[model samples]
Target: MWVTSSTATALLPTAIALGNFDGIHRGHQEVVRSIVGVDATGSEDCSIRRTVVTFNPHPREFFSGQRRQLLTPQEEKVRLLEALGIEQLVLLPFDRELATLSPQDFVEKILVRQLQAKRIGVGKDFHFGYQRQGTAEDLRAIAQNHDIEVKIVSLQACGRDRVSSSLIRQSLQEGDIPQANRLLGRPYQLAGTVVTGQQLGRTIGFPTANLQLPDNKFLPRYGVYSVRVVLEKTALLGVMNIGCRPTVNAEAKPTVEVHLLDWSGDLYEQTLTVNLEEFLRPEQKFSSLDALKAQIQTDCKRAKDLLNSQL
Candidate 1:
C-alpha cells in the first residue's frame, strides 16, 4: 500500500477502512477483503480507491497511562496491508486537537472532505469523535446524509473466543505460540537492532547477538524458542532466549539473545527480525554457569533438529 502522512496533500480520493488494526488480525482482514471484493464488482464510474486510515501514537497510549503492547509496528502494519492489496495507507497523527473532533466534524472534515471516501468499513464496536461519542449507528446516519456507503463488519471469532489483539497478547504472554499464530494467521515475530551484551554467552561457548526490541511491541514469554532470524535480509535458524540472566544474578530487564546456527559475524547495530517457530522451554534459574551452558547445548541441538526437520 502507498503509505503517506496526513500532511501530504497529493493523495487520491479513496474508500477507507478505519481502525487501529494493531495486529491486522482476521477481523481486520475481513474488512479489507470486503473493500477489495466490492471494488472488483463495481463499474468504471463506480471505481473506488481502497485505503486504510490508522493513527500513530495509538489513541490508547494518549488517553491512558497504560503502555499498550502492540502486535505490529507502523512500518510492518503498512507492509502487511499492502501485501493484502490495499491501495493506500493514510497515517493520521493523533494529537489533542484531532482526538477531540466531534462526530459530525470528523465525518465532514476527514471522511468526507479530506479522504473523499466513497465507502467506509468499520467494525461494529468502533467508536470515534470527542470522548468516543460516535458509534457505528452514528457513523451510518452520517454516511447516509453524506452519500457515503458504510459497511459494519461483525466481530470475527476463532473457536469459542473473539479474535482480537488483546487476546493475541494474552496468548503470547502465556507462551501459547500455536494459539497466537492461529489468531494472527502467522507466527509471532519481533524486530529490533542487535546490540552488544556482557559477552557471557561467548564464554559459555554459545555466542549470541543481543537485540533491542522496539517500544510498544509486545514481547513473548521469557523463554527459549526455536526461531527463524532474519539478519541483513537473510533468514537463519536459531535458538532465542528472552529473559533476564537469572543464572548470573543479573538485573531483571528483559533481553532477547539469539544464537544463530553455524553463524559468526559482527552483528552489532544491525537490525534483526526474529520469528518464533515453536516454544522450546520456559526460562529457568540454573544451579550454576556450567548447568546453564549444558542446558544451552541441549537447546541448540533441539533447535538444529527442528530446523533440519523443517528443511
Candidate 2:
C-alpha cells in the first residue's frame, strides 16, 4: 500500500478504514476486511480507493510527551495493512490544531475535504474530535450530512475475552505468548537490526545475534523464549533471551539475544524479525559461566524440540 501524509493532496474518492490499529489484531483485521469487502463490490469504480487512516506519533504518545510502547510500529503496521489489500494509507499528524477540531469540522474538513472519503469504516468504540467527544454514532450522523456512508464494526472476541491491542499488550507483558498469539491470529513479532554485543555467547559455544529494537517497540516479559527468526526468505528456529544478563554483568541493560539453531554467519547490522512462539523461562542469574552455559544448552534443545513439533 502507498502511504501519504495529511498534507498530501486529496486522494481519489475513497472507502477509508479508520483507527489506531496498533497491533492489527483480529478485531482490527475484521474492520479492514469489512471495508475491503465493500470496495470489492464496487470493483468497476476504479476511482474509489481502499484507504486506511491512522495517526502518526499516536495521540496518546503526543499527549504524554513520551514515546508510547507500540505493539506494531509504523513499518510493521504498513506491511500488515498492505497484506490486507489496502491501496492507500493516510497518516494524519496529531498536532494541537488538529486535536481541537470539532466533530462536524473534523468530518467535513478532514474526512470529506482532505481525504475525499466516500465511505468510512470504524470500530463500535471509535471516538474522534476534540477530547474524543464524538462516538461512532456521532461519526455516522456527521458523515451522513456530507453524503458519506459509515460502517461501525462490533468488537471481536476470542473465547470470552475481547481481542484488542491493550489486551494483547497485557498478554505479552505477562509472558502469555499463546494467548497473545491467539488474539493476534498470529505469533507476536519483534523486528529490528542486529547489532554488536559483548561477544559473550561465542566464548561459551553459543553465538547470538543482538537485536537493537526501536525505542517505542513494546517489549514482552524479560525471559527466555522459543522463537522463529526471519532472515530474508529463510525461517530458522531459535532460542531468545530477553534480559539484562545478570549471570555476566548484573548492571547490564536489558537486551535481546537470539541463538539460531543450526545457523552461523556474520549478522551484524542485518535486520531480522523474530516471532515469539513460546515463553521458555524467566531470566535468572547463574552461579558461574559454566552453569549458565549448561542451562543455555538445555534451553536450545527445548526450543528445537518445541519448534520442530509444530512441523
Candidate 3:
C-alpha cells in the first residue's frame, strides 16, 4: 500500500473511505468492500483512486487521558488494508489544529478540495469535525452540493451482537479466545521482546523467557494459558503465565513467562510473538515454592495435551 503523510499532496481524485478503523473489524471491512466494488466498475484507470483516510494518535486519546488499547498496530493495519486491495492510505496526524476545524471546513478543505474525491464511503455511525458535528446527513448534503456520491455501510453483526473493537477487547479480557477470534477472523496475538529475568524458573525446573510488552498495548487477564510462540521462523507450543510472581513476593510488573516444549535456546533480546490459544487457569498465589512448581507441571501437561489434539 502507498502511504502518504500529508493529506494535501497525498490524495488524487479518488474514491475515499473514512474512519478510525481501529480494529479493522468486519464492520469496517464492509465499508472498504463497498469502495472496492465501486472502483471495480469505473471505466477510467485514474479517474477514481481508492484510498482510506485515518488519523494517528487516535482522536479519543486527545479528549480522554486514557485510550482503549489498539487491536492492530499502525503497521499491521496498513498491511491488512493492503491485503484488502486498498490502493492508498492517508495517515493524517491528529493534533489541536486538526481537531478544531469546523465541519464545513473539514469537508471543503480535506475531502472535496484536497482529495478531489468523486465518491466517499463511511460507516453509518461515523462522525467527524470539531466536537463531531459532522453526521451522515451532513456528509450527504456536502456530497450533493459537490456532485460526489456517498455510500453508507451498515454495521456488520456476528451472531446477536455487532462486531466492534470494544466487544473484541471484552472477549479477550474474559479469556474467551474463541469469541475474540470469531469476531477478528483470526487468533489474537501479542509481540514483545524477550528480556532477562532473575532465573527463578530455572531453579523450579522450567526455564522461561521473560517478555516485555509494548507500551500502551493491552494484555489479556493474568492467567496461565495454552499458547503458541513464534520465534524467528519456528512455531513452538508452550504454556505461558502472565502475572506478577506472587510466590516469590516479587514486586515486578506483569511479564509473560513462556516455557517452550522440548526447546532450548539463548533468546535474550530476541522478539517473540505469542498467540493465546486457550485459558487454562487464573493466576494464583501459591503458599510455597514447591507447590507453585507442582502446579506449573500440571499446567504444562495440560497445555501439551491440548496442543497435541490440535496437531
Candidate 4:
C-alpha cells in the first residue's frame, strides 16, 4: 500500500494524515488516529481510504541535497503505518515546483483535485507550501472552500516537555534510553543486516553479530547497551556495543555489534532488529585485548541482569 507517486490518481475518497512523520511517535500517532480512528474505518458515511501523505526526499533533505539521519526510514515507516491500519501511503516528490505551490494551490490542487481528500489531519505546528508559509489555520480556511474538513490536532506533551521527534533524538543522543523510549511509546530500535566481522569475539569464545545499517540511519550514543535482539519473530537478550573497537583499533569507524546471551547460530546476512534497553557504559579504550575481553564479560553479565529484571 505504498504509492510512491505525485500524480497517481487515488481510486477512493481519502482521509489523510499529512506530515513528514519522521518517528511516528505519540504526537504523530495522534494526528493519524484523528483521521483513521482506532478501527481505521476512516469516515462514517463513505468508504474512505485511510491514507498518509508524506513528502519524499523530505524537504530538508531536498533543500540541503544531503540525506538526513532518520528515526524511521521509508521502509520502517511504511511497516509501522500499515500496522496502524493505514490503507495507503502517498509519497509526493519534493522538488522546486512542489515547493513553489501557494497554500491555496496546495490544498486545492494537491489534496482536493488530485488525492480527493475528504478529510485531512495535521499537527498544530504543521506547515506547508511556498516557503512553508501555510499554517494549520491556513489549511482549515482554505480547505473549507472545497468543503473539506481539516483537523488540526493539538500538540501532545509528556510531563513538562512536548512530545516531538527532536526531543526524542536529543534523548537518544545523550544515551537516555528510558527517556527516549518513554517519548517514543516504544523502545528505540535499529534494524540491520547481520554481516561478517573481524571474528575477534569468536576467538575469545563470544561470537558477535555485526550489523550493517543504512548510510543515513540515525545512531544513538556510542556506548555499551543492554538490548533485545529480534530475529525471525524470536526475541533474544544481548549486549550491544555501538562504537569503534578502540582497544582493538582506535582509528576504526563506529560499528554496531551485539553478543546475544545464551544464543548461538550462523546469522550471516540475516536481518536483526536491536532494541536498546539500557545504556551500561561509555566506550573506553583498554590497554590490551584481554582487558577488553574482561570488560565485555562484565557487560554481558550486567546486560543479562537488566534484561531478566524486566521480564
- lDDT for each candidate structure: 0.85, 0.90, 0.84, 0.89
Could you tell me how far off, in angstroms, the CA of residue 249 lies in candidate 4 after the best superposition? 2.1
Kindly list the per-residue Cα lDDT of model 3 for residues 116-227, writing each as its tens digit.
8888899998888999999977887887788887888888888998888889889989989878877877677777899898889999899999888766677888889898
- 2 or 4: which has the higher lDDT? 2
Arranged by lDDT, best first: 2, 4, 1, 3
Shift of residue 21 alpha carbon in model 2, Å = 0.7
Candidate 1 per-residue C-alpha lDDT over 97-119 given as tens digits, one digit per residue, 9 for 90 to 100: 99999999999998898888788
Can you write out model 4's per-residue Cα lDDT over 1-311, one digit (the tens) per residue? 74656557655678899999998999999998888753223436447888999998899999998888999987788888998878888989899999999999999899998888888999999999999999999999999888888889999988888999999999999999999988888898989999988988899888999999977788999999999999999999999999988787654578999999999999999999999999999989998888888999999999999999999
Can you write out model 2's per-residue Cα lDDT over 32-139, one digit (the tens) per residue? 987785553454456788889999879998899987889998888889999998888889999998899998898988888877887889999999999999999999
Residue clash pairs of candidate 4: none
Candidate 2, residue 301: the lDDT equals 95
Number of backbone-clashing residue pairs for each candidate, in the order shown: 1, 0, 0, 0
Winning model by lDDT: 2
Ten-residue segment with the worst summed lDDT in candidate 1? 37-46
Best of the two (1, 3) by TM-score = 1
**Per-candidate alpha-carbon RMSD to the true structure:** 2.7, 1.6, 2.7, 2.0
